[model samples]
Target chain A: MNIPSKLIEDAVTEISRLPGIGKKTALRLALHLLKQNEVHTEALTLALTRMRQEVQYCKKCHNISDGEICQICASMRRDKTVICVVEDIRDVLAIENTNQYQGTYHVLGGVISPIQGIGPEELTIESLLERVSLSQEDEEEPIQEIILALSATMEGDTTSFYLAKRLKEKGIKVSTIARGIPVGGELEYTDEVTLGRSIMTRINYSTE
Target chain B: MNIPSKLIEDAVTEISRLPGIGKKTALRLALHLLKQNEVHTEALTLALTRMRQEVQYCKKCHNISDGEICQICASMRRDKTVICVVEDIRDVLAIENTNQYQGTYHVLGGVISPIQGIGPEELTIESLLERVSLSQEDEEEPIQEIILALSATMEGDTTSFYLAKRLKEKGIKVSTIARGIPVGGELEYTDEVTLGRSIMTRINYSTE
Candidate 1:
């Protein structure tokens, strides 16, 4: 495009660097910003810069926080005995939205992906182990279980398998979230892998 | 979503305000920025703020520019007697990409859309008339033609119609870009309106 102004081109280039945004979308966004009030643009810039500069990660759970430890890990009401392991902060947010789980979370940051050169060591796996061992040594209500709540992908499975092996040696029970046909899903439209897994893991029907 | 950090939530809210972006996509983008280098985030923020704070518009044609007059309007080689009226700077960029036109441009800023509460008074129509009248009084090469290069939408047609009526009173030729099947397009799937218009506006074939 024959951009008339250097500033517009610069802004477009910077915006297009974002993951899903392309040059045309970036141009549209830049033009939109130009047409809007300066206060709106300033607010967006301030929020992005401030978040990047001031954001902190929880020392215990590795989740995003405003201080050394996150609110979830610091809350006394949360069940410290059970740790729901997740791949990133988004997972933490997703699970928290359900309001079903009462346990604390251990954010691994990412799962084990060989193609991306990310392994167990690259994640917060070591810290998780240390947290478990330290809690056990303290003799306080020892951690009873670790829930592997990672994604249903190869990387997630590999990470879960490695952590289960290590946690078993430490005498801690490890569990995984159930995988089956999603609620409201039609079996005919379901992929074979998921349908097969759902049937294989089907539980006995019972009534009180 | 149960966002853990206020900073993350703030950034997501701000980013999602852009056109076409949703809350989930904003969250993803915000987290992506969190994981990236501080330099990348800083560059994005700086560019947006700088563009909003320092960008200027051309006084003659209202095109985005770094100076009082835009580069195209300031260039002496461009045809001064012909003006292509467009809706916005993006239209100017689109036409410039074609590299077929050497005339100048007049950015109307927007089209007439009563549904959106936008009218000709909201655009730069008055200034366009003033420019033409001023050129005519100066006895210089007066504007010989005004090409209506707005979009094919109803609002664009309304704005063009309004401008054409006014320009005709000034005795200047008014024209619009052709409406027909696009170049290299197949007729089998072409829309009936465009195909019919193409046939009705067909020109005589001649060879020298």
Candidate 2:
């Protein structure tokens, strides 16, 4: 039998569904919300509600947005020719947080994983191709680059290879970001300076 | 200047307003949501909205509920004569997780903290007293017992003392849970078995 009230139990169940939050953590968060003043709890509830109502996918690049187009796609300052393709919007935020990338992003939504039943058609690959075809104004210039900034997992590799082949057929220069230890994730498995240097002197992927 | 889109920034800002979440963690959670499927995202958002719209405080016990009375207050199996007084609904969950307590709960909403300007008047103390006065039956068996299961903190102690005095005039038996060292909070400062022994040989407080 359930020990907590149905309301509390529902909140805990929802919280536990989040990544990294276990049953104990969910209970803690639920209880904390309960202790808060009605106004405070109301604000949290409103934010959660509005996050759904307001947020949407950018029509152009498939990145997260509050409108028709993502900020990156809408911005005139970003390099339109150099599109960094990633697995999800989290990668968009990760690159954005680095303050190192100036190109716009294309969120693939997820990687192509046969094991997971995710194929090329399942992603926004068609939209990406359509966006790449938008070079009609300057056909001679061609798209300068398509950077594959996908994660360094097996699925990410397979997806990158698939994307590279598809983009290469359209005569676009496709390049995968170097595979190395992540800044986060598991760290004790890797030595410190080696991981940092791997990031510094990364190699490009090539069929040769 | 804000680093991300205004709506995304605003969402993160609002999420960080919760008790333990910081800006970094809020960003992580927001990015995680942005990466999730729209259906999953909508579920979380809806849960938050429903929490505010549907959930209410139990008029009788001050505990959280989706109706006028919480399920604990509504349950027939729970012992109504015995009340377990706690600092918050979180404490209620903690006790409930043990599966040892069969009595219903009364959430204080918070402990007494002079520094934070929180006192007896700010809590559900008056409601608790009213509950006691009205609960007495024709048989005159008295409201058997009240368990003061507040935390072992200084503020918790102060609140228990204040509550004990208030209940004593009504001729109700008030008891407090024992305290010495916590189960896991800063264990390096405590001896091994003392904490274990404290849990084994708990003494009841006699509010005479």
Candidate 3:
């Protein structure tokens, strides 16, 4: 596109650096910002800058936080003995939104993917292993379970297997979330692997 | 979504304020930024802030510029006699990208839309009229034609009609861009209004 001003062009280039945003969308966004109140743009930039510079990563779960530890990990009511292992903070938020899990989370950063040159070391796997091992000696609240809540992808499975092997010596229960067709999912569109797994892991029908 | 960090939530809220962006996309963008190098975030914010704070509106045509006069208006090679009147800077950029028009532009900011409480008074129509009237007295390069390159929407047509009536008194020739099927538009799916207009405005074909 033939941008009239160098300043607008620079802004568009920067905005388009984000994933999913194209040059056209970036230009539209830039123009929208220009048309809006100056304070609106100022607030947006301020928020983004503060988020990038001041946001903290939890020391325990590695989830993003405002301080040294995330709220989920610091909460007293949460199940301290259980840890939900997932790919990243997004998964943590997704599970939290479900309102089903009362346990804490251990964000792995990402699943082990050799093709992308992402191994166990690249993720937070080492810290998870250390946490699990150290929890065994904690007399007050020893960790009882480590739930492998990672995705059902090949990389996720590989990471789960590796974690299970490491946590086996710790004597903590290692389990995984159930894999099945989603609540509103139609059987006709369901993939064979998931369908087969759902059937294999079917529970008893009790019409309560 | 359950965002763990307050800073991330703030950033997401601000990012979602842009047109077409939703809360989910905003969170995804925020997380993507968090994963990227800090310098990238800094560059994006700095560019946006600079664009918002330093960008100038051209005094002559109301198009955004880096100086008092836009590059197009200041260019010696551009035609001073013909002015392409458009709704906004985006239209100007679109026309410039075609590399066909050599005339300068007059940006109206927006078209007349009573539904949105926007009228000729809200736009730069008065300034455009002033520019055209003043050009007639100029000894050199007096403006001769005012081409209306507005959209085919109802508001666009209303704005064009208003301008045409106003410019008629000044004795300047007023013309509009052709209304027809786009280069790759399919007649089967084309709307009746556009297809009818295309037939009505058909130009004679001459073999080269």
Best by DockQ: 3
Per-residue error (Å), model 2, residue A33 = 4.1
Q: What does DockQ come to for candidate 3?
A: 0.85
What DockQ does candidate 1 score?
Answer: 0.84
**lDDT digits (tens) for residues A71-175 of candidate 3:** 999999999999999998889989988889999999988889999999889999889888987887888888999999998999999998999998887778999
Ranking by lDDT: 1, 3, 2
Compose the digit string of candidate 1's lDDT tens values, residues A55-169: 9999999999999999998999999999999999989889988889999999998989999999788999999999999989877778999999988898898999999999999
Kindly report which residue stretches of model 3 are placed more than 4 angstroms away from their true locations once superposed. A200-208, B204-208
Candidate numbers sorted by DockQ from highest down = 3, 1, 2
Q: Which DockQ-derived CAPRI band holds candidate 1?
A: high
Q: Write the per-residue lDDT of candidate 2 for residues B39-136, one digit (tens) a residue.
A: 77666656655665566788878887767888888998888888999987777767888989888889898989999999889999999998898887
The CA lDDT at A95 in model 3 is 92
| Model 2 residue A85 lDDT score | 96
Worst 10 residues of 1 chain B by lDDT: B199-208
Give the Cα error of residue B41 in candidate 1, in Å: 1.2
* Minimal lDDT window, size 10, model 3 chain A: A199-208
Give the per-residue lDDT digits (tens) of candidate 1, residues B112-183. Answer: 999999988999999999988888887767889999999888999999999999999998899998888889
